[model samples]
Target: MRLGYELKEAAKISWVAINSNRLRAALTTLGIVIGVATVSLMGSAIAGLTQTFEDSLSLLGTDVLFVQKFNWATGGGDWREMRNRRDITLRDAKRLERELSMAQAVSVEAQSNGLVSYEERSASSAAIVGANENTAMVRGFLLADGRYFSEADVDGLRPVCILGSSLAENLFPRFSPLGERIKIRGKKYEVIGVLEKLGGFLFGDVDNQVMVPITRFVSDFAYNPDVNISVKAVNTELLDDTRIEVRGIMRKIRRLGPGDKDDFAVNQQDMLMDAFMQTGGTIAAGGLLITGLSLLVGGIGIMNIMFVSVIERTKEIGLRKALGAKRRTILIQFLLEASFICLFGGLLGLGIAYPITLLMQQVFPATLAWPVVLTALLVSIFTGVISGYLPAFRASKLNPVDALRQD
Candidate 1:
């Protein structure tokens, strides 16, 4: 009951401090507000980016594993060395398919960036992927209209194509791309199908491209001396078996003997996620370092304000002490006042941060995870206790006779 009464008294004193030094309190808390706001906003943005990448990868199917000449979307290591590596060709893909009974399906792809044209409309710098019929199943591509290229078309090297949703919309705005003739690299090809909209990959939208037979691609553009082969496991449960089988097959195909390091890379969803996480950790560390400075300045400001409050309230402290107030009471009151200021500042910062985060989400469709919010709140409260300690101690140790003697 005495603690409750003391708390009420401390609350009343904190209210007095706030009401008396409104402008000074605002100025003092500004650093804290900015620090909290910055940390919260940056965390939310990073989380949103992480979620976007995860969503894009999830769409690509976690069961699929890519066999590539080099790491396709991760870790920058000796690109020149990777570039000099040999290509994985259609034959390699065929060999893998034939040897690996555990493999569900296999596809080979080559890509060129070029202009796609349909009469008056043309899309410049569009992605043109050369793939076989198995690409539809492996990449989870769905047909919006008409049909995907058949195995016969791929084998015959027929001049046929499927338009991604964006490419179709761009090249054939007035009518459907299916059954229409589109020119790619000066060669006219029939659009056999239009692919449904599959939103952005980590690189960008899969729907903003065109796909043709791997044979036709090789015949027209030829392999750039370096092409990647993508392999999908039949079932996720067989992932380990598939990996072992693929390693054996690729080793035989590449003619690498025992004790030789594999020249090629096997890329998977976890590899991409790990790469992104490492990058995100670096960015978050940098952000925290910058924001830590701001929080330090805020802490200093809190200490300064409390010191000033102690000096200014010397007469009040003397009178309270003369009237039977204890040193502990004095300590608790000043500390509570400082803590109140920090808590208020933190709440205010959150008010600003949350709305900004919501605005970003509305504008960019980004995800803001709850953990980020909770973390920011906790950090703010922690700042209050740590920053207020020294001044609270100073206030408690004041000599009542000396305080009363001061003007």
Candidate 2:
């Protein structure tokens, strides 16, 4: 028989065999169905989580750097020793600003929690952030209405505030927040601007905060407290050079000698990204462990069903061999049977997983991707081939006389 004719015949025969024992075929496919669904759903969830994190990262801006007293990673560190390190102060920020020319904008930040109130409206838990005038450039926050505080505003200790979008909505839902007065810690401050909505809180949401000048914050809150400095580079391409210069300047400002180990950390977006990657790797590893076991069980089920199939069709195998069928043709036919079973199972699994992925999106950010579908399909086929090999080989090697006499 020609190759195409043989393949067509094999498919028709497999289909008829599956239909003849539909209950058995369906039961055999359960393992594959569960395995594919678990793996594809895990993959889709991780993809969505990564994208959500990236969106949050975008608001921080890759070109900006944060200079602080503590390293984000804090690897192999003694907590007491870290606590003993001097706090990063406003004076350090000033010194760095005076010395570092590569920096486009350098601003110091401090924050406190307080109730934000406007007349009858109030948000009890709100971050009252204290930062310098160039916050817009450094933090990458855009204005929804009005304008950010100016250089003169910081120097003058003006009682002006910028509301984060969510905070604005809470405090002034019916009217515009611009030119409105809100009380923070019993002090009335004029609202100058409201920030555009930022992505969800992976690193604390900016949308639930209020921004004010660092000078006003210190006067009203605490003086000489630890503060974080944000430095924006003049050009993103020269960010590394800018970081190097700023690091040296910060060390000098902190009075750390060349021989002495630095007390403070110079942080960038990539450091946080590394942390995210580590988290992603850990989740993936756990998912793979669970999914692998499920798939292994499924493969064994497929192998067991294939062996049973070969035994049940002993007479059929003998008849095919007696009618001048080659061993290769017999092998191909049985292999195709196993492959089609897995392929169908994979498709059914995808159908089950699609709605699950959609439901997951409603609770968290997640979606099924085409690549994940393709991977499940390929994995199923590969699994079928591996599992069916022994059974197909035994079927092909059976002698016509022995197989015919078995029944």
Candidate 3:
């Protein structure tokens, strides 16, 4: 009964404190509001970006592996390590295709940035991918219209091209692009097909690009005879064997001794994810540090306001004490008021955060994790309790006579 009565009295005192200084209470909560909002926003954005990357990575297929001059996922390594390396040539890719019966398909790509023009419309520094027929299967490209280049086109070095969806839209927005001729570096090529819209990847929009035969690329635009290749295993079960076979083929082509280390890199989607996660970890840590500082400042604001409240209501405290209020009651009252301030601010922050997050999702379709939201709320509550301690202690420790005598 005593504890219930004390709690009731504490509630009454907290209500009075809150109502007595409406403007001050609002001001006190401002820091908390900003802090909570920032933390929530940052958390949501990071989670959304992570989800976006994961989705994009999933599109690449798990069983596929890329053999390239430089590692795509892991960034720059020792220059000396790559200095003596010879490029993986079309012959290397051919050998792998012919010898590796266990592998499903092997494809070679020679990429270059060039100007593509159709009539008066043109795009400069556009991605021009050079590959054979197997390129589509290895890279997961789907034809929205027409057909991919065939073995005849590749072997004959025919001046035929496939347009990415975005490129097609940009160049020939109102009509079908099939049978139209586009110029690449003053060379005329017929658009044989249009690729489906693939959004954007780490390498940007696959749709806003052009693809031509490997033979044409090599004959007309081969900057170097050796370029990297991409190979896909028959299935997940064959991935290891395929890798081993590819390594042996590459070593033999390069004439590297058995004891020589590999001069090339084989990268996969998981490797990309691992590299991204490491970078993301650093960014998240920095964001958390900034958020922590903001939260600390907000907590201090709450503490300062509670202290001022205690000073302003010293006589009220004395009056309650004289009427048989316990120290614990006074402490609980001030603490509850402080906590209420933070929690109120947190609710407001979340209210604002939800809509902003929704807007972000609309702008960039991304997944928002609920755990992040719950964490933000919990942190705000914890901040309130921690910040209120000093003020509540002061209120509890005040002498009744002294408090009453204070004007």
Candidate 4:
């Protein structure tokens, strides 16, 4: 009961001290405000990056694997090695479809960039995708209107095409694009469907592209082209087994000897995700280091101010100690003052960060989640306790006679 009463009395004293030096308290809290804001912003950036990457992964099917000449995660330095790799062809895709029992679907894909025009409206630098019938099943494309090209359309080399949502809106703003003829590289194609908006991925907009039959794309665009094969597993649980099966069958199809290293690469969404996670981790580590420095500077400022506060209150501390006030009471008083200052600063920093977070979301993904808020507040309190400890200890240990004699 006495301890509780003493704690209440200490808190009251701490509040009075802070209220009496409002300007000094505010100035002292500047470091903590900056530190907490920095930490919150960094956390939001990392979280946003992670969310964006994961969303991109969803578009690239988790249960699917890509067979290509070059690995998606490979750096520029490995381009030379990737260049020598044998091109994955339509024939290889067919063979995989025939041989792979574990695969739910297999699709061939090729890409090019061209100008897509409808009347006077045109989207330049538009991605042109050559996809087989199984592409929809493999890539998880959802149609916003009309229908995806059928197997018959692919086999017949039909000039039917699907417009991505963004492209469709740009090309046919007033009316539907279904059955409308559009030119690709001057070759006419009827718009058969519109893909739902899938946002951006890597360097390009996901919804700023068009899909056409691979047969037409190959004949119209190039004489001979390297293609990518997408193989979807029956389920996510069997993805690993499917990948192993695909690698073995691809090696057999390529006529690679048992001792020979596989020339082509089998890529999965996880490969890109893992690479991104490593990069994100590096970025986060660097960001944390910078934030740590800021917090450290703030902590130091708090410590300095706390020491000053302790010295200024020496006579009061001595009077309390001389009148049967416990050392714990003096310690609690200073610590509470520091903690309240930081907690208030942390709340103020969060208020500053909220608008910045909203602005950041315009250019990139950023969210001030609960965990970040909780962490910032906890960090503030922890910084306060640590910074105030030495000063509080000093005040608690002051000799009453010497403290009272101070000018």
Best by lDDT: 4
Compared with the true structure, what per-residue lDDT tens digits does model 2 show for residues 1-407? 58899899988988888889998889889999998899889888877888888888887888898888777663725667778999888888888888989988988899788888999889898998998888887888889999999999999999999999999998988899899889998889999999998856485559889999999999987787689999999878989999899889887887888898878888888787787788777987798678868877888999999999999999999999999888988998888888888888888888899999999988888878888889988998888888988999999999999999987
Candidate 1 backbone overlaps, count: 0
TM-score, prediction 3: 0.93
Best-first order by lDDT: 4, 2, 3, 1
RMSD of 4: 2.0
* Alpha carbon lDDT of each predicted model: 0.81, 0.87, 0.83, 0.88
Which candidate number has the best TM-score?
A: 4
lDDT of 1: 0.81
Candidate 2 error regions (>4 Å): 73-80
lDDT of 4 by residue, 49-124 (tens): 7888888887897888889888877362377888987777878878888999998888998989898988888888
For model 1 the TM-score comes to 0.92
TM-score of each: 0.92, 0.93, 0.93, 0.94
Steric collisions counted per model: 0, 0, 0, 0
Error of 2 at 370 (Å): 2.5
Q: Which stretches of candidate 4 lie over 4 Å from their true place?
A: 72-79, 200-204
